[model samples]
Target: MVSKRLFQSVAEQIAELIDEGAYPPGTRLPGERELAEKLGVSRVTIREAEIALQAVGRLEIKTGSGVYVSERKPASLGALPQASAFEVTEARLMIEAESAALAAHNITDEAIDELETLVNQMSSDDEGVANAADERFHLTIAQASNNAAMVHTIQSLWQMREQIPEVKATYEAVCVHDAKSRTDEHRAIFDALRARDPGAARQAMREHFQRLLESMLEATERKALEEVQLRASQSRERFLAAAKFG
Candidate 1:
């Protein structure tokens, strides 16, 4: 089946070539423009596809050199920068709100329909499917903005969201408890985009992140408290044991 995302499709093609030994491990691939021409895709798509491949350890990108196929796949999270969930949420609140507003002005009927389908997927009982849909829904909005920079920035933010262990854990904790709210917020954002109301779209996106940020804060505090309590209990147990020996 064809992949919905262009970059993903390109990445798959590149992986297939590597697997077929057309481009063996440690072999540097063609430059972006050359690869774009070969694949019939844009340079931006080629870049995005390479980044995706690198994230999965299928490829390695070197500055001042070129992209190379990796001999082994590494743990994805270990390669990402350490970012807290709060930091990522705050960044998304600012950037994605603008992205949503811009998308509202430029989004087509096709993108709107795609978002609606994604929202439905977000309602699925399978957590993995719903989470994947949520990611695509946001990316589709980013693409609809008709801004390459915005799409790249949002894609980076999403990489942090999915690949950073702490960020991923916090989101999972918050989302597991309030899946309905999460789905509803996405639907609100989609509705605003479909209506072509930039202000409403911005507000919806901002509100989504605002709630997420607040939830993360609450979860963090609760976690800290639980850790403190756990340590105190352990200390108390040690004290009682010593006292009994005395």
Candidate 2:
């Protein structure tokens, strides 16, 4: 069974495609069965995704007819940077590692405690709660850097993470398979910060993203391989967009 947020990710993917003109305004989307097969998800997930897109005015669903892309684009789409998951991850690795190092030196005991709480919260069964806590955990460390510029930069990266459909989908897919690894990595970084070890903190943060990047590659390759016999070009193109990092 998929998490509640999986359909949101699917909705984002459809919206992104519409925005990119793959499905132009007024273009009818494929049937739920086709989309489900293409995305390797349940038909119920496709239905939920379409309903979500319709609710956001990105699509129009007719009772007898099919879902069509809306001509009216979302206002916030233009504000988000056009970046792939790999680019976003790469940026986070470079910027956040330094932020973690600085945070190790500057973080207060209370902030450390807060991070510990967030780390524990990440182990929650509720995906929404765990995801929110994960964001807070990183932001707390970024804030601990005591550098406004660093904090702003980290915030922007996270905005890219959350707002970009492909990035968000890729992350959700990888995260679903590695929740334990993610929590352990966060703990390592938290431990480094608590010890006030800048070098260790930097290394821990780097290791976290490094593992994330590697996992993304593995997931992308695996999915592409699974779908290649059916839609080799399309599957490869989609996964490659998310797996561009070294």
Candidate 3:
């Protein structure tokens, strides 16, 4: 199905192309003038898309040269800054998979202790504190991967979550179920990490983040859309009042 979202459509199209191997990792994309011509969008739109893609670690734009696809596909894609809920999922799928794998090899006693502390911190009597600590726990996991870039990219998701109020609310609500699933997932991931099994660690990370991704995507974005209507009404009122005053 064609995406009704214009910019998102543009981003997804590129993301899919990379996934399908049509764009191929480490290959350079056409220049802005050429891409805009091909994409049938203004160069400005192309520029915006590139930045958005870059934020999520998808495409690397070299001003002196051209835009080139990064060596890592899924991780690179994850590193790109998230522009939407789907993008966040895309990034999580890409980065966290590798994150889990690396954590399996990198886990130290200190890291394990930190994880336990985070589990305790997750119970934030206050939601704001909870979210903050929750993000910190995830960030610590990503950092444990020993990949600086991955850590930075995953951290970016914290800001993206702010824009996604629905995701925050829904996930927070889900955390109420004895918080068993969450603790279990963290324990499973720790088990893998302690064993130094890369594949299992990655798998655990995937399952946990995938649940979150699914829940967020299921949340209808009607609230944000409704705000558009409110803005329109305020704009019209201001215009009419201006005409009457004049």
Candidate 4:
């Protein structure tokens, strides 16, 4: 019998294949029997693997048709540098505080106008549009800093958030919890920058990340509690079964 973990391993392998363009977007995946034969796993295991990928928005299942790769692929699920949401937020606090301070000194009227536009877009009710605008707003600040290296560094960090599945998952969960607060935080940062107050900008940036760190800790604790409860329930079920058998 294949272990439960094997299902996840198989899912990761399939995700790698998708990442490598072996199965491009909108392409139909091979049947479960074919995948089982190719991977030396049972059909049931293949089904579980497909389910895992589907959960992350990597695959689309069409009833009466077939499984196809989703147009929007998820972050690579394979082995990659995994950073906790807190660590990413911590790194942002360090780097972005300085970026915001520099932007306050070097930002032009044109950049401020652009930032205002992005902030308005971020306040929209649409999550996707708001999220994209949020990213652009930060990158715009990096650009205003007039440091090519800082721009490159900040862009690289954002790309990592997109490419690492665990980080993306954690951040998505956090976003869902308190997204409205982020708009207010961005506004505070913008206000400090517009006033050309470097110290205020830096403080605002740091406070934004401090809130994120607190949220991450709360989410982590809640997840741990859920897992503990699940394990306890499983143990109780096993005990009852064994008692009945004895």
RMSD of each candidate relative to the true structure:
10.0, 15.6, 14.8, 13.5
**How do the predictions measure up, each by TM-score?**
0.72, 0.64, 0.50, 0.66
Model 4 agreement with the true structure over 192-229: per-residue lDDT tens digits: 99999999999999998899888888999999999999
Give the number of the best model, judged by TM-score.
1
lDDT per residue, candidate 2, 164-236, as tens digits? 7899999999999999999999999999999999999999999999999999999989988878766977788
Query: For residues 1-246, what per-residue lDDT tens digits would candidate 1 score against the true structure?
Result: 633677778989988988899998888998989999999987757876776776566776553356888777544444666778888899999999999999999988878887898899888997756876787688778878888678767877888886677888899999998899999999999999999999999999999999998888888899999999999999999999999998
Best by lDDT: 1
- lDDT for 28 (candidate 1): 93
State each candidate's clash count.
0, 0, 7, 0
Better of 2 and 4 by lDDT: 2
Off by over 4 Å in 4: 1-80
1 versus 4: better TM-score goes to: 1
Worst 10 residues of 1 by lDDT: 72-81
Model 2: residues with Cα > 4 Å off, grouped in runs: 1-78, 232-246
Q: Considering only N, C-alpha and C atoms within 3 Å, which residue pairs clash in candidate 4?
A: none
TM-score quality measure for candidate 1 = 0.72
lDDT of 3 by residue, 1-246 (tens): 633535456767777778888787789988769877877875545655665575567876543356778675434322334266666666777887898788778766776776666666566565444444455456667767888778666756654654465544555555664366666776677677767899988898888878766555545355567788899999999999999998
Model 3 vs truth, CA RMSD: 14.8
lDDT for 71 in candidate 1 is 70
